[model samples]
Target: MQPLLSSYSSSSSLTIFLVSLLLVGDHGGARIILPANVTVPAVIAFGDSIMDQGANNNLNTLAKANFAPYGKDSVAGIPTGRFSNNRTPADMLVEQMGIKEFMPAYLDPSLDDKELLTGVSFASAGSGFDPQTPNLLGVLSFADQLDQFKEYIEKLKGIVGEERTQYILTNSLFLVVAGSNDLANTYFTIGIRKLQYDIPSYSNLMVSSASNFIKDIYKLGARRIVVFNAPPVGCLPLQRTLSGNEHRMCAEKHNKAAQLYNNKLQAELKHLHNTLAESKIVNIDIYKPLLAIMKNPKQYGLEVVDRGCCGTGNIEVAILCNRLLPTCLDASKYLFWDSFHPTEKGYNILMNEVVGRHASDWF
Candidate 1:
């Protein structure tokens, strides 16, 4: 698919293709979907806050959402350690796929019959590829998330037998969203910045860890993978608020580092797709679409661009994202829900871009 896009030297042809495809689809009653042979039976999310939902319940860290006003609009209006007030992309993905609700987070002890069989989230807020990054934020590290996954697998084997568990692995959706915390604490914060490895070296380390994690999932029976490239972290509200210079410029140095990481990740996924012939790995370009909105929020009729609706919107994210600080009167006008996340509307736009890739229509 990327090769076909490359044929059109300039991106103009790519836009032409989008238009042509839509025109043709409108003419026909049926639209092209994901490959007909594709099958997604369960969803297994691993990584960070972007996909976490109360998974950190068992962790002793400050990163938790099992409280209130979090997931407030969602099932029971209960905080689910999701770092948000409602369902996240991980949950949303499973819903779109027509799967049962996202598997329960690996932590919740109340785990019973239904939740255990559906799917689960191993994601943790503040979790990152680099182990040290989570320290500053006091959240689960990425490696810990994997340990959680292992436990889930072990339990599933108990419930559904090892042979059937293997079948579950080969047919589930493994979705990942991480790296922002690494960029924020490791590079943006002055302390971690002091011993910073060069951008290239850091990116290599990230790619290596992430790729290995993907391979581990493949070995465990995950055949369909939807991998998300890190978003343009430097452009996020948290960064903008912390920049302190008043100009909402993204930390370019950090963004470049993230870009280098994404570039490598793309190549690695292509390689993985080839090597794991029995599975399908999809790379969802989260950075590009969000960047488009960041650069031109007015195009989307978004007014509050640099700051989040949560009060001052400066450097206040996660547990700090609240009205105890300066908050916007109407959050809908803002792009970010908290300093680090998106409003429901913002998520809707992101979903449009991401879901298309999962569909057969695009990638």
Candidate 2:
């Protein structure tokens, strides 16, 4: 399979491809099901709330989304700390790969030894690559997450022995989705970082932190790692509402910072690829596609792009987006479910872009 849609460019072509892949069945008159021929043995996730399945629920943090309307359209129809109204990119990616239904939160006490073999997410809500970002928000730091990953490896070794564990570690797909919080929450916010460093310097610090995290994971036996660059932070509903003034325009300054960080991150990943033998450190640009979606909402069947589906969508997120506030009846019409996060429908579009971009790498 030399990538299913290597030549397709238009959205109509993409839609046709999707139906053929997801809906069409075999000629035997039964639903055509295939075995999961996943390239990796497992998919480990480490990042911020964008990839946080339900890790924050176990932590003593103010950033939590394990409540009603959050999981309004999830597989179980129950909130599991995902910021979206339904399944996230993490959920969609693994399923499309035919690996598993959903990646469970690593901190979930109910996770058994067997489940550890597939994979679990270590991402926490409000976390950032910056050490102080998580600390400031009272969430798990990236450093802490890495330590947890180390411990997870040890536990896996105990369960399946060292040989199998090594194989799993080397073959697993490590997903790193962070840095948005560092720029959007910590640096841009009226905090110590703003007083200490300029946008360029702060972005450099983020790149350094992210680069170190990648190197550490590589040393820990990760081989296939996909690091998602930060999305357009300025376009986020919260940022727009905060700085958009009365007209509610996007904060271009924040978007520029996001681009700066992404450029640096891509350069760092390329350097890692050249230096770290057997390590596949890939950089995925999410901002471009996401920006297109926001710019042309009609192209993606969306109506509300300036606000979120959860309450006002201006500033509410995590705990602030509570059950007391009524949610949008049609989440599909909105790009964001909350102030900063995309709705499940929005995430679905993102997943399509990811798969289209990285299908060759996965296959």
Candidate 3:
């Protein structure tokens, strides 16, 4: 993976700050400290559009930015393939924690330029734990994204020295939002294994792909991993709308497959934490939170439960998500900002539920 990557640190924006945070105590090896005068070393990110900043914008693929109505409502008010009008949950998390405002995408061509430094966002839109899905979507795969991180590490080592760079990355928080693409694209898109394998076969593939992805990030010195699971795809407006059956909801068969994969992921990840020579992995159950929110939208203050902000949730997403082609009157009111993605408000609610102190088996 290291050799397969392009030279990192070529970006002038990449630099190391001489900073450190002390672990006052431990939560059974978990590093949970008082939110006082603490310091954040760095934040490294990976996954899909949920955490993506501008990796797709630099890529010469159909899945790109360089447009409007995309970031229109965003503070930036300019498109950047973020899948949101403003900063994502990852960004919000960073800010709330008093770290940098945003993370950097290792795949961004501007890595060599230190001006672009904050944290790195390697989550390419249309990409996922399943590498092949990106090939179909024409985006970077999870493995490739990790490869970029490895290269970034090496570059940082050269720029700031290995020990210092490792220290920073080793202590940094990692928010990995992935695996959603697999459920939405694979099982539903092409009917996974319907051509060859069955549900078990495909689910196994997903577990392996995602589990290994977490391991690789760990190898790169990430200690805190918030590995998010797939959202309630069945409850998503787009899915319900596309099925065309008002009563039809997300594909239960697909959600079942996703839940199965997540369960396996949790077990395997815990085992990895137990077995790994020197590392820790934390499971961030984005799945359950989203499910709860969907089950009780009223709890989150949402009115229109079935429809997206787009005129018709289902039709609006695939066609006018960012096309300037009449979209929903308000992006905040809808659960789904687009067909397959959530609105800034939805992500905020989603992230709110994810908030709290967690840990691995170590401090």
Candidate 4:
């Protein structure tokens, strides 16, 4: 096989093209032989819609997007409840690591023992660290996701036996991406937490919740864990729409809140890494990259930064972004695919940056 690096002009382009290939199949695309060395045995994802592969499809949640126009650029050309046109960050990271091109949803009925051996995503759409977040959408909470993970381990035990399951759990890469919904959707939109706690107090709650989650998973034999910081939710199309003014911009207050929470979360992660035995808890700063894209769309080959590709691009998402609604002709030009989610192209760019800048140090 030809070297993928030589074939592509840049890493970002390589990542984007490779993700498309992964989604559809090689389809006569470059087939670069991945290095024999595997970084992590598997990548187990836990979070909200950002990482959800299709877990919400099986649930009676209103946050589902398993229909047409959602996966317009995907290989299957059908919605897979991924919250993107194609694969997500989870899929990109897993594929980039040579674990698998596609990580199946743990809740999918067709999930087999073979797929479980490599990896599977346990994330659910509309989930968050705060219980109220999921409660609002009738989706899984952080605790509920943890419970599902526990159930997954039991199932793994049955498939690969106790010892192998333990080995996989200890060696695999555990990705936790929460809090975005907690702040953006739950606290801000619903105002339930605002009535009880102030911004600082609420951010502290998010940090505490994240710490508990990391510690719990560490106790469960997870050694390599990557937790994502909340992005600039204020920059999301929905939030911008809520700004009301015709000349709306990224909400500064919300962005500031995200930065504060991220600072606290990073400090907590560093402390956890120092304390946890044999654990490598790493923090992935999602805010900076995402914010950069929003600031300079041309820098990332994106034309539209303020709105999404689906329908009105301001507030429509999930159920509202149906097949009947007109979507952008080329999703690649748009930074966001929906009101709250990044486009598949945007995810590819993020994945490339993340793997290039961060993964080398950890792996």
Candidate 5:
């Protein structure tokens, strides 16, 4: 096979062309091959909608996308509770790692032993590091997800036995993506955390919670972990609609809060990386890449950035984005699928940049 890197050019034209190729069919996008020495047994994901892959389908939460218009572009044209138009960052990450085409949800009833041996997502759509975030939405909390992960370990042991389970646990790549909801929902939108703590203090609280979660997973045998920082929460279509004023510009305050939390989270990860034994913990910044895409959609072969592809694109998400509402003609041209999540094309572009820049850090 030709080297994937050889196709990459300094200009944005090739990237845009590649994105167009990705949109041609379901799961027909370019494949990402890692270095020869790198060995990732599986790819496990945990966190909010960005990483969720049908984990919310079984749950009775309004934060679900398992309906029409959600998976209109997927292989079977059926929604799988993923927040995007098709596959999410979780699916893309695993695919990029050459593990599988899709990442199954841990709660999927139809999940088989083969999927379990590979990997599955335990992430909940509305979850955050903050406990109150998930509680407010009636979705799985971080603690609940952790418990499910423990259960998954036992099942893995049953399928592959102790030795292989341990090997998979230690060798697999674990993705922790969250914090956008905590700042976007809990702190600003709901104003629940604001009463107790200001931006600085609230950010500290979030970072502390995230650190604890990482440590907990580390204790559970996660050796190579990638913790994604909060994206620019203010730039999301929902935030722009709610807080961006009449012009619907990016909310600077929310962006600042995310930046603050990201800074602290990066520092905490560094500390954990140095202190933890045989652990590879690194923080990948999704903030800048997404923000850049939003700022210059044209550079990415995207046209609409201020709104989503669903409904009016101003504020629709999850249940609000339904069959009743109409979506954009071409989701690949839009940066967001709903108000809060990126389209599959958007995710593909972002993942390409992320993996290209940070894949080496895992080793």
Candidate 6:
């Protein structure tokens, strides 16, 4: 399949046409067809708000997004705790894999046995590889999420026989998206980690934690894994509003920190891929593609790049972006739903490229 974005240009008419095409259905762009060699029976996810489906809804944390204007564009037209205006990347990934239309959150009480077999997201909105990141926000830590995965495994074994459960686990596509919160929130915005370690050392800590998480899951039976690198956190609307100059340019320092972590993470994943037995661990580069769209929004048929579609688009996110505030008339024109998360259309664009370019590597 060809890439969604094969070239970049500034033609207004072309941008308008592409934007129209992107807003066609629940998710835009051409559908992804898996290769004959691949067999993704399930698509499991773990990480922060980027991959969070609704795991934060019941948590007593400000990271929740189960209210208003959050799911205005959803099929049901009600908030589902996703950080986006509609479906999240987790949901999109499952759909792209042809396993299911939506991936349920592991914490959602309504999940049935069928959904469990398809896969679920254990991600919390404010979570990071850093244990303290979720502790500070009262959301599920990586350890807590891992514990939830263990519980899920037991439940799956109860539903299906041990052999089938193992088959499902071994064939499922495991997506690990994290480290953004560690750099953007814990280290830079919160400034707590700065007191402990500088950029390189903290990157090491994140890499080590991520490595352990991968190994832990590998031991549990996961073989086909995709580890997403940190996005350009500096370009996020929240970062720009906080650290950008009067013009609110992308925060170069924050981007640098994210790049540092991504480089370390790529190297670590490479090492793990070589060492792990019968494992296919690949690092997906979210930073470059996202930065490309941010640098030239029109290339992706998006208008607002520096800000988001909700409220002032500068600092509002999670609880701050609520029903009381008016959202943009057309969120499809915007790249972000809130200060910290992408809109459904933006995620579709990104996922289209991701599944097209890298989905085959897992096999």
lDDT (C-alpha, whole model) for all candidates: 0.65, 0.78, 0.61, 0.77, 0.83, 0.82
When 1 and 3 are scored with lDDT, the better candidate is: 1
Query: Which of the predicted structures, 4 or 6, would earn the higher TM-score when compared with the native?
Result: 6
Winner of 1 and 3 under TM-score: 1
The parts of candidate 2 lying over 4 Å away from their true place are: 1-38
For candidate 2, write residues 289-308 as lDDT tens digits.
89898889999789998888
Per-residue alpha-carbon lDDT of model 6 for 1-363, expressed as tens digits?
012123324463243221111000127555557777767788889888877888888877667789998999998889998888998888877776677888889999899999999999998877888877777678888899899999999999999979999999999989898888888878887777898899999999999999999999999999988999988887887777667776778889988998999999999999999999999999999888888888788988899987889988876677767899899999999998888888999998888877778876877
Inter-residue clash pairs, candidate 2:
none
Per residue, candidate 4 scores C-alpha lDDT tens digits across 1-363 of: 124224435754433222111010011111223345744678899988888899889787667879878888887698888888888888877776667788888888898888888888888888777767777777877888888888889989999899999999988889999887777656776677998998899999999988999888888789889998988888887777664255667887888888999999999999999999888889998889888878888987899988889987866677767888899998989988887788888887766666665774454
lDDT of 3 at 304: 56
Weakest lDDT window of 10 consecutive positions for candidate 3: 18-27
* Each model's Cα RMSD: 12.0, 11.6, 11.5, 10.4, 10.4, 9.4
Q: Tens digit of lDDT per residue, candidate 3, span 1-363?
A: 132113324441121000000000000111234345434566677777777777877665555434655565665577656666555776666665656555556665656535223467777776766656677656788878877888777777777787888777776777777776666555564444357657677767877887788777877788766677666665565455433254656567657777887888788778877887666577777778777767788887665556555544543332244465556677766566655666777777766656643432223
Deviation of model 5 at 179, angstroms: 0.2
Off by over 4 Å in 6: 1-26
Query: For candidate 5, lDDT tens digit of each residue in 1-363?
Result: 023224435553332221111000023345566678767788888888887888888876677889989998987899988888998878877776788889999999999999998999998888888988888777888999999999999999999899999999999999998898888878887788888999999999999999999999999999998999988888888778768867889999999999999999999999999999999999999899988987788998899998889988876677767899999999999988887888899988888878778887886
In terms of lDDT, which candidate is stronger, 3 or 6?
A: 6
Candidate 3 off by > 4 Å? 1-39, 107-118, 357-363
Model 3 C-alpha lDDT versus the unseen true structure:
0.61
Candidate 4: regions farther than 4 A off: 1-39
Superposition TM-score, candidate 4 onto the true structure: 0.89
Clashes counted in candidate 6 amount to 0
Where does candidate 6 clash, by residue pair?
none
